[model samples]
Target: MKKKITVKLDIQKIVRITGNHGGYETGECLLCEASGWLEGEFGSPYSTKDTGADLVHKKNCLMNKVLA
Candidate 1:
């Protein structure tokens, strides 16, 4: 039997890397007031690729814990 490898999503790291790039209305890089946890111009910063969505969040937002 073959085992499947899973990669955990790093919210903090992604936030750090994409800092300020995503368009947030708060005028602050970290603070976002969009419907989702994080707001970006095209899609979620953590997105594997651009999808043209205005806002996006992971199934579970780990970054919120870090921010709070």
Candidate 2:
């Protein structure tokens, strides 16, 4: 019998932005002030939906509703 090994990848969570440039009059994320709001709040531009402006990546907020 062969033993299988599983590897765990160590990766940090980095919020990603997917907003269109020149789309909004103001080029800034009101939710997280990350400069990108159109993008889904998750893993470069995290939004307040996850954490408030006071805390981002520093503290985890259960406000991000990925599907909703």
Candidate 3:
């Protein structure tokens, strides 16, 4: 039998990397005003790719959705 490997995203690490004073996530949030989340843009922060934190902005931030 072969084992499957799964890699889960760490919200705490994402929060720290963003220079925020908190670390936590609940369910699948698109944009959490209480948490100060900002959706995503269509351009590039460049460094975001290096740290792999873009997932929060693109997948959960919900900023873009709000703008629409």
Candidate 4:
């Protein structure tokens, strides 16, 4: 019999921002201020839908790494 090993990724600490902030003008990580392609497309500190910003932060934000 062969045993299958599974690895668990900790995602409990990941925070998703989904609000409109008057001060938010760039699509950057609110915690680390890291900017990505989403920022270029949607402008920095975006106030609209945050799905793109969330994706970018999850992929490249230093804050996400630290939290994880």
User: On residues 1-68, what C-alpha lDDT tens digit does candidate 2 reach at each position?
Assistant: 99998644222233334344575321332334343233333332234354332223322322233312
Candidate 4, which segments miss by more than 4 Å at Cα? 1-26, 39-68
Better of 2 and 4 by TM-score: 4
Off by over 4 Å in 2: 1-26, 40-63
Best by lDDT: 4
For each candidate in the order shown, give its overall lDDT on alpha carbons. Answer: 0.39, 0.34, 0.34, 0.42
What is the model-wide C-alpha lDDT for candidate 1? 0.39
Best by TM-score: 1
Pitting candidate 1 against candidate 3, the one with the higher TM-score is 1
Among residues 3 or more apart in sequence or in different chains, the pairs in candidate 2 whose N, CA or C atoms overlap within 3 Å are: 14-43, 15-44, 15-45, 16-43, 16-44, 16-45, 18-39
Candidate 3 structure quality by residue, lDDT tens digits, 1-68: 99998655444343322333254222223233222232342222223443433333343453334333
Model 4 accuracy (lDDT, Cα)? 0.42
**TM-score between candidate 4 and the true structure:** 0.21
**Pairs that clash in candidate 3:** 39-63
- Candidate 1 residue-wise lDDT, 1-68, digit = tens: 99998656554434432344354431222334223323433235334343444344343554344433
Task: Supply the TM-score for candidate 2.
Answer: 0.18
Judging by lDDT, tell me the better candidate of 1 and 2. 1
